[model samples]
Target: MPQFSLYEEEYHPSPLKRTWIEFRNSHIAVVGLVVLAGLLLFSLFAPFLAPYDPLAQNIDGLLIPPSWTVNGSISHLFGTDALGRDVFSRIIYGCRVTLGSSILLVLLAMLIGVTIGTVAGVMQGVRSSVINHLLDALMAIPTLLIAIIIVAIVGTGLVNSMWAITLALIPQFIHHTRSFVRAEMKKEYILASRLDGATNRQLFFNSILPNMIEMLVVQGTLALSIAVIDISALGFLNLGAQPPLPELGAILADGLDVAYLAPWNVALPGLTIFVMVLAINIVGDGLRSALRKRLVR
Candidate 1:
């Protein structure tokens, strides 16, 4: 018989570690993680990585093709735009602005949404139904359209667009969180916790929130992709980051005017946005799968 010792340690991994291990098991998830990480690192180190100031114009380099193209120079790898700004550098800086702002916007949305949702869930009555009705009405419109309307009212600029996107996104988060919390509240554990003298706050913080966190995390990840797209869309429409901002959407918009002369300007920024959204969705799907599997176990 194996002897059990009081000092014997068990190698129990944390939930986060377990979730990561599960996430790593998927090939597509790993690929997504790598791509997302690379983009994030590139954005984080943009100041150091970018070869030139994104806003600086080089009159001599206007509309230069990619470096490998005929008449292209090695100095400007992705070539120059109509304004003679380095396409590569602008793209690098654009990633920073786009991704950084989107993530923050999503987080802010999640915080406000979750708090309101939890309150509604705990106080299920006419108030909860009213909140749900409000969310349904808001969510009926497309998120981008809602954002556009908000931006139109608040006026343009990156910061205003971000706020608009945050407001647009909050409805979805609130809807999902309220549903999740309400469902979780119906479980036996919640009843037991209540019987044991757990207050609403204690129940949420100690039990309900923990069980629902995985879903919230996956929801937030998905919302982040939406935020990125909406931000870029606003920028493309001239309602987001303005002149010299090097926002991906703005760069793409700028490229369109001179696309016939400098195709790389349009292509690179569009491609970057596509890749960023694809990677984010892949990671979000992976998280959902991993968390669901863990819950089943």
Candidate 2:
């Protein structure tokens, strides 16, 4: 009793507070962020960073596996495709095509879906019911099948493929945002703000929408993973990213012949897509958790 433990204050920080800090400073979250940043950078700079043209082939080098040539040279570090193009370079460049189109589609879908959802959520009754049903029906359809149908009808080009993916993605955002906004509108803060003679537009834009921003941020991150998967499936089916374009799915399809013989060609691109999607999902989960904590605090 006489010796008041002076070290107690330093040692006994609140567990909840420490947990919150740890979540913010967590290793998985940090590594996920780094991985995402690196992928983005690689995709953006692929044209300059890649050693050789992804499409150029040396038939003389056809099917040559990766090994140091006796003359102090190597044909392809990751081996050659059936056509003898450098697999390493193609896989690197393919990241740009895979991610770029998927991102554009997701953004477009978000813009359209979020706008519609926001408006629908602010309204009620028949309008909301109608909108909800429409979204539900769209969601019921398989995304992959829809992509196949749209591409078959529209003809596969980069623009068309993006449009197809965007169309498929919009239903999900529409449903999510509308639900979030509708519930947020019933909160006491929203009612109080309205009681103060805030205009409907003002209430929506200033009160409701701002509160929903954190949720939207989380949704966008999760949506990116879906977009990547959808695009890859489309590309694999030959419904997206036409020939001469270095697409991850198409590259994987081409590598199936000798995948066991020279594994890196297929492995590199598939791994890139898998890691990107996984990284996005992990970050999204962290963001959702963090945002909920922020709301509680």
Candidate 3:
């Protein structure tokens, strides 16, 4: 009889592989992932994908309708804006601005918030107490209000507006991370680690942090949806991306002026924002469900 190797006798898939298998089974999640990927790819390659320069003006071709319309031309499929800039090109380029800025803002906020929250959760006494109280106070103020105040202090611009939004989002991450860490601390693994002579730093870095990864990923996705909305709102108010930049919010704001004669100007950008936010949310929900199933297993 042939001897079987131990590895072959007791084969098991890695957690990541298992989680991916489970995630792939969800139809909505799969669709959302596809849409999100398409958007990201389009944004990343906008320069090559766009037919015309988004900023170039054709004064004579201004306010043309979409190509499907009788007066529209194939050269400008989505039509031209008030300044005769290609609407399709601007929309394509705007994806980069909107997604890139929001992603950067989320990352910055996550780094600051997770660091502070983890420390507060692990180290007891006045420090933790103070951090919690500070987060509570910050949370009480509306996110938009906080963003507005920060924008005012930093002065107006696209980069500054992102900074403002990042500041406003930090408290949310801190709160969520703190709560997750505190809950994890009460679990049996933490006590087992302590009894096994594991140092506090070792336990946190090796054990606690690894388990928190899934929760953090879920929270990050959810936060992204909120970031998208806030960034657009700021842009609409003229506190974010400035003129001639082709930002979605700025595009929508400009469209408002010519909405009567060229409704596509307002409709297209507004619809884009709506679809982007919806796709993000659907993915977030699907991730939460998939991760929850993994935890249960």
Over 4 Å off, model 2: 1-24, 67-75
Clashes of 2: 0
lDDT of each: 0.92, 0.80, 0.89
| Candidate 1 vs 2: which has more TM-score | 1
- TM-score per prediction, in order, is 0.94, 0.86, 0.93
Positional deviation of 105 in candidate 1, in angstroms? 0.4
Q: What is the Cα root-mean-square deviation between model 1 and the actual structure?
A: 2.6
Query: Lowest summed lDDT over 10 consecutive residues: which window, candidate 1?
Result: 288-297
What does the lDDT come to for candidate 3? 0.89
Tens digit of lDDT per residue, candidate 3, span 1-297?
998776756657798887887888899888999988888987999999999999999989999899999999998989999999999999999988998888888999999998888888887899888898999999999777888899989887899988998999999999988998899889998999899999878987999889878877888888888888878888899998899888999999999999999999999999989988988988888888887888788
lDDT of 2 by residue, 146-172 (tens): 777898899986667778888888888
lDDT for position 263 in model 3: 99
Overall local distance difference test of candidate 1: 0.92
What does candidate 2 score in Cα RMSD to the true structure?
A: 5.1
What's the distance in Å from true for residue 296, model 2?
Answer: 3.4
**Candidate 3: count of backbone clashes, pairs at least 3 residues apart or interchain:** 0
